[model samples]
Target: MTQPNTQIPDFQSIMLPMLNLLESGEVFTLNQVVTKLAEHFHLSKEDLKIKVPSGQMGLFRNRVGWTRSYLKKAGLIHYPERAKYQITPFGKDYLKGKPKDLRIKHLKKMPDYIEWTKTFNQDTNNKQEAEITKEIESQTPEEVLASTVDQLNKQLATDLLDKLKENSFGYFENFVIELLQKMGYGEFREDAAERTGQTGDNGIDGIISQDRLGLENVYIQAKRFRDGHVGSPDIRNFIGSLALQGVNKGVFLTTSRFSESAIKTASDSKQQKIILIDGKQLANLAIEYNLGVQVDKTIAIKKIDLDYFEE
Candidate 1:
């Protein structure tokens, strides 16, 4: 006799029960649902982690959120409060008629599921309409593109930041220099304290040149910070150090984020043109340069040529 192949349940499988649990008057958090779903399906936490973080399970606090999102779009659910979700009369009817041998594949075959999918797509279209309206209200074409790129850069930066160790400040400094170099600022060197005369050697950490033979200099002050922002005082000291070195262009890089005052101070200073690169910017620079990361694939998008059709 041939053995039956065992099928492992996906995110939707776990979500249905969680939704059912919520409908049955059981209050549960995302963590609680994850635990219970894992046990019920005999799934390992690792397996659940992969699906939950990126799949439907991750869409809300629990499977309830995705269910509610779908059901609400289908007019089968309604939100009473910001976070609280409940099913509607249509949802109750759908659930009552739902098959006992419920599976993700089976759900697709159901009429209610098809209706929910259609409504879900329509809701998404409505959301896109709202976003387009908001964007049109507030920004110019150039500003919109710039804002979109900045958002993408920030998301990439956050991903890289998560991979870095908290105490690896030295590594962070090196990462920043490499990023700047990739950004067309070449002839760079680090920790050049040998040229500093007495008086405790000011606040500068390193000096980088844009060209050969140290002609055009860009001084840098690298701070390895864990918490608490870099203050205006720090910015002032960096400017003072730049003066001592007779350099007008300077970069202040830190692992920790900078305060608004620090940024304002740097911008407000008339003595020298100081550039402030905070933790977020530092990460973005790294991504732009592909310093510590590699590109897996490149996607190119193009539009149809209407001129060719006319010709």
Candidate 2:
């Protein structure tokens, strides 16, 4: 069989066709519309499998879903029962106009649509609302939300690293130990850890175990530097320190990045295993393990339970 076209229509482009499909006044489920719309667009198997950035839903289905929402908000179509939709008199009149395209701009001219938008815009300023609407027009809502969260996490990581740099060396050492423990190193055995507490103290800062029984130990060298790269000489010196202690494994944590030579030196070491955790990585770890950050807020998104309405 010949493959259908692979290009999925944008949400805006899907609006008119979708409204026309519903204007038959037959109540249809979302899955039914998704199937019909895919056929209408001649979307291929590859197109049907295409997912949004979050991989939560297919690209075509997501656009079609949002188109349904837009039509519903504009009072052109609505859910008569959960997960089922049908067109209204307004929708039939809308089709009679034979508009070139049904889009957010056309919906904005609708009083019901404007009022529905106000519910979401109550807390946002005019500029923010406009920006949000612009993004909604170009991208799926899930894509927009994911992009926002990624941007926030990056900024949070930068801020978190900056705070780490401002803290004292002792505090930084304690933080790294706590992070490692949280990650299952030393198995949270408080008795199996120690701090060197002095500068140039054989180039070692702390030590912890790799397992609960303390069968093996990992040496740590925590450097809280604000503005310089950890160099190869520093790594070699730490290696020497580990050799003095007769340890074969070490982790070097720094609030600044490591040089290429330093990384290579660690990788090339045959007798010892050295792990380097740079500032960005350190902050990300802290975030991942909830070491230095707290949950500020939680937002819950709700959707209809189709099974609840099923016979």
Candidate 3:
């Protein structure tokens, strides 16, 4: 009996097999590609089910995603649709050499791959040296990719906050109203949000209808601060404003972070539920809800057809 291979293949090790699997130019889904690679590597059920460090998904599945991401970066694969991918002519030609394995070193030989590397790390202007590339090669593709995404999002958030500071208080109010709508507030209705960031509103900027029938209301206290923190006094005042209005829930959003005391004040409130959204949280929400963002590009991962073996 052949013992199941206990070792899980890294993203680079999975690259060659991934390309070969897609070489037929057939549109394959990511799941299909994962299964083919698992079978090709003779991974046991246990091996296939291993979890990544985050444990949000199976490690093998993450590796499969990274494998596809790398191939897509190298121009070996292209997504024909949202969830479908196929190999390109260049990929097919590259496979003619029958390279036993694909590695970062080998990828650097390709102009598209090199360009893709630069594109992947957009903020980094310097060309990646051998050491940096090798270090990246050491980690699983998902790890590198996730870190890259986080960095990009952080930079974007900083830029977004700067822009927010430049806008008028009225613009900030409208932005929040639209943002809440995108986040499924008020059932995503255009009229779900009402801007009341006017004077004499008792620190309340706006109000959001929790339901289409308007049975409940979520008060919004939008603060557009540049560098100052939203301190405990601000939170207590908002909590007081909620009390005066007979409202129980409020969102105190600021383009700045909350002090420890402020966070504690919100948490320690027994009768009121105050949700604190800081600058970073606000920026990420904007990105997630696609307020001012647009889809840059999409990559599709592919897997094998299981029914082919059922018969």
Candidate 4:
């Protein structure tokens, strides 16, 4: 069956209606919000069923997630649990005005919102520069394919981080193990890798044998630090521990970014080979390797038939 090309309203357009849904100060799960907003916008069943390019979830759900994310960042809403939020006191106050201009510009007034927007814009700029190449008409086939591919990958990466944070430490350790395995470290899959976080081996999370016989090893440290940046102290401690174990290779993975000093520390360690994987890089790797991702669909763009003109 052919999918419809219908469009749902952008996040900015849904912002006001969404805030109004929670304006009464009642808590709602994401499903409730998505359903109510869909009704308000009068989206058809088919429209609500439109899957994102990843085919993981409906596209509308993805947009609504962003709507909640942006609002949550601006301090207008608070998450009581995963995918559930209660309107904030500030949210009620702002809704009292029945805001018509709840655009991103207005959201930027909040410092948190500014930071969130910066991260999102940076991702977009990165993809745009690499994939799009040059501006073309929206009707252009190449432009459409490249643009959608870029957007889908960005969404996938963001969602991966979101889900990873909600998981347990054991889950995260296994996730990192799986990621490395998918990255071609699975040749010695039998006993090559195991979680050591449970044993608390000098802050090392896991170790992957570089060879099946365990001749060489790569120490793994996975930190699911959600908020704070990993600094030089963390890197130095990991490296010092590696030296104590007489290991030369280590991989440090974090769901947060590493500070410049931390990055520099790894670079300056000539005795040990260290690789730092940030949340963004980790997600991108997962996407590239299909670790927690799948191919949604492939698009082919055909050009004019020059043979017809020659004839």
What ranking emerges by lDDT with the best candidate at the front? 2, 4, 3, 1
Residues 261-280 of candidate 4 have per-residue lDDT tens digits of: 99999999999999999887
> Which segments of model 4 are wrong by more than 4 Å?
1-9, 29-31, 38-66, 69-100, 108-140, 297-311
Q: Model-by-model lDDT, in order? A: 0.59, 0.80, 0.79, 0.80
Estimated TM-score per prediction? 0.49, 0.55, 0.54, 0.76
Indicate which candidate wins on TM-score. Answer: 4
Report the number of the highest-lDDT candidate. Answer: 2
Candidate 1 vs candidate 4: the lDDT winner is: 4
Q: lDDT for model 3, on a 0 to 1 scale?
A: 0.79
Model 3 agreement with the true structure over 163-250: per-residue lDDT tens digits: 7867898888888778887888886566777888777998899999998877799999988885557899999999999999998999
CA shift of 148, model 1, Å? 9.9
After superposition on all C-alphas, the RMSD of every candidate to the true structure, in Å, is 15.0, 19.8, 15.7, 5.3
Order by TM-score, highest first: 4, 2, 3, 1
lDDT of 1 by residue, 162-279 (tens): 4453436556556666666678776344432222222475876655677666678777777766445689999998898888878789889875567779889999989899988766
Clashing residue pairs, candidate 2? none
Better by TM-score, candidate 4 or 1: 4
lDDT of 2 by residue, 61-180 (tens): 878877887787688997787789899999899889888887777888776565444422322233544787686789877887788776566556755765776779999999998898
| Candidate 3 residue runs with Cα over 4 Å from true position | 1-137, 301-311
